[model samples]
Target: MTKFLLRWIASAASIYITAALFENVYITGFDAAMLAAVILGIANMIVKPIIVLFTLPINIVTLGLFTLVINGFVLKITAGLVSGFMINGLFTAILASVVLSIVHVVLSGILGVKKD
Candidate 1:
């Protein structure tokens, strides 16, 4: 439970940081950012794997780069689901996804949260 909460907070912080870095990615407030993080985590867990599995051939053809697109798609979905979270374009979403991924990784490492 503690680990889950820690991860949630990490995701929130990642979203906050990513929004701060990108002009096209807009997070209304800290609370909205937190909600967006939670929604993104859920979307990643539930929808991402399915999308990846279906897009496996494309992913392989792209030498795994298409996985980034999948991540962006999920991030866009998250933005749509969260009222205050707005992503301006597909390109921006992809860029924001990359930033979020880096922030999440760095935060997890700094927080001593082991990857599953």
Candidate 2:
């Protein structure tokens, strides 16, 4: 439970940092970043798998690169659901998702938040 909270905070920080790194990805404040992180977590946990399953053929064709697009789609869904967390366009969302993944990894490692 404690680790989960720590990871959640780290994920929020990653979202904030990712937003800072990209002009098109706009997070109004840390509060918005936090909300966006939770929404993103939910989207990834539920929506991503369904989308991935539906796009498996394309994913195979792209050698798994389509996963990036799916990630972006999830981010877009998050933005739609969370106010003050806005992504300007699909392309920007895709790019932001990549950066977000890198930031999340680095932040998780720095915070010693291990995946279970």
**What TM-score should be assigned to candidate 1?**
0.94
Displacement of residue 113 (Cα, Å) in model 2 is 0.5
Give the per-residue lDDT of model 1 (tens digit) for 1-116.
Answer: 88888888899999999999999999889899899988887998999999999999999999999988999999999999999999999989998899899999999999988778
Candidate 1 local accuracy as lDDT?
0.92
* Predicted model with the maximum TM-score: 2
Model 2: CA > 4 A from native: none
List TM-scores for all candidates, in order. 0.94, 0.97
Positional deviation of 72 in candidate 1, in angstroms?
0.5
Q: Each candidate: what lDDT?
A: 0.92, 0.92
